[model samples]
Target: MLDQFLWVIFPYLCVAIFIVGHIWRYRIDQFGWTAKSSEFIEKKQLMVGSILFHFAVIPVFLGHIVGLFIPAHWMSAIGVNEHIYHLGAVYVGGFFGIVMFVGMFLLTFRRINNKSVRKLSSASDMVVNFLLLFITFIGIYATLVTNNIVTDFDYRQSISVWTRGLVTFSPDASLMTDVPLTFQIHVLSAFLIFALWPATRLVHAWSLPFNYVGRSYIVYRKHKK
Candidate 1:
């Protein structure tokens, strides 16, 4: 029952909240849908951290899409075996994971230590930052220590299958029942983030500035003397 709740019920609940929350927030607070960037408050640390975090996180997000959504059989069909995939995932994922961790650390530090930034920051902002940091730290530890040094647990077999099942509306709680504890925490924490996403500035992630692409460029004229 515990496993069923954690693996099946909890995930669907988070997904439902994630979907409905965003719609409600968008309807009521469209103007507030922004990252609330603190570049003006503290440019130096913000620039460095924002650059590193955004750069690393894009690939990390894409990697998750591939790892979770793409089936192992599909990769096998393309001639990529388990050993090859694992090596690539470990090295490439680990590198980006470390970079993301450093970036998040800098961002979190700036938000907490810089008085100007802290003054502008809301409680939700701090909570989101800390949650992200925790998730990234656990991800790195899971990749480097838990999966590598402690034991060779190929999550693709269990976690990946279970994830695909969830999206397809046929989740198998049994798949997640025997996986490592670290992975279980990682998955649950990630869902928690998703559940909270709409309420936080993280909602800004969906508001890409695509309008800038086709919009006319600004033109400047010399002022009359």
Candidate 2:
């Protein structure tokens, strides 16, 4: 029942919100868009934050994909132990997940508490980071407490079925309620964050290569007569 409702509701809600968010927020104002280029950019600090964010969270995302999205039968047919895969989901994924949790929290709080950074930030800025805080918190909790739920229904199985549906665009609602309330919160938070993505600095995620190319150029002065 719970799974069915989540399977039906959150998926559609999240996807719709995600689609509409990009449409509403994405702007192409190359001609007029301008911000004062910072002369005091702190390369070292930004690099530290980015490293933690990417390295820690990225593997977690990948692990979730494997654990939640792939069918147990498919994995077993290929001779992989589902428990091993699930452990990767908890320990490996959860490690980076925690890294992301801590890294993002530090970034968020730094933005809030630092006077210079605070003055320059907006309500939207707080909103964006706060969203991340909620999502990651719930994710951590879900990963930790899932084993405590009645051990009858396997989380990996339900997650796999749901994820497969997510990939195929059919979206299974059956898995949502069967798991646990904690699981539902994780699902809802995930969809909400996805829906909220385009509206926040989170959009930086899409502008990868050009955004962080750390290249420096040398200019030589030549006199023009």
Candidate 3:
């Protein structure tokens, strides 16, 4: 029953909240949809942290998509065995995980240390940063230490299938019953993060300026004096 709620009910609840909260925020507070960038207050730290975090996170995001969405059979079909995949996952994922952790730490430090930036930051900013740090650090530890030294649990068979089942509206909570405690915490933390996304600066992700593309450029003219 505990696993049922954590794996099935909680995930669905988080998704529902994320969707509804996003709609409500967009309708009632569209103007507040920004990352609330503090680049003006301190560009150096922001640039270094933001760039490093984003670059590293892109691969991490893609890795999750491939790991969770793509089945183990698909990789095997493409000549990638479990050992090969796990090796790559550990090496590559660990590298970026460390990079992302460092970057997030720098950003969090900057926000806390810089008076102007700290003043400009909201409670949500601190919450999100702390969550990211926790999640990323756990992930790195899981990949680099736990998986490498102790047990290299291939989540593709269990966690991946479970996630795919959730997408198909057929979540099997039993799949997660045997998953490692560290991985379980990581998954739960991710769901919590998603639930908090709509209320935080993450809403900016939905408001990309894609409309700016294919538009005419502004022209400036000097008046004769």
Measured by lDDT, the strongest candidate is: 1
Clashes of 1: 0
Instruction: Name model 2 segments beyond 4 Å from true.
Output: 1-6, 27-47, 166-169, 210-225
Candidate 1 collision pairs: none
Computed on alpha carbons, the lDDT of every model, listed in order, comes to 0.91, 0.69, 0.90
How accurate locally is residue 50 in candidate 3, as Cα lDDT from 0 to 100?
86
Over 1-225, each residue of candidate 1 has an lDDT whose tens digit, in order, gives 988899999999999999999999999999999998878678998888888999999888988898998989899999998888888788999999999999999999999999989999999999999999999999988888889665657788899999999988999999987888888888999999999999999998887899999999999898999
Query: Lowest-scoring 10 consecutive residues by lDDT in candidate 2?
Result: 30-39
Estimate, for each residue in 82-148, the C-alpha lDDT of model 3 and write its tens digit.
8898877989888888899999999999999999988998999999999999999988887777675
Model 3, residue 188: C-alpha shift (Å):
0.3
- Cα RMSD for candidates in order: 3.0, 4.8, 3.5
Candidate with the larger TM-score of 1 and 2: 1
Q: TM-score for candidate 1, please give it.
A: 0.92
* Model 3 per-residue lDDT at 133: 93
Task: Order the candidate numbers by TM-score, best to worst.
Answer: 1, 3, 2
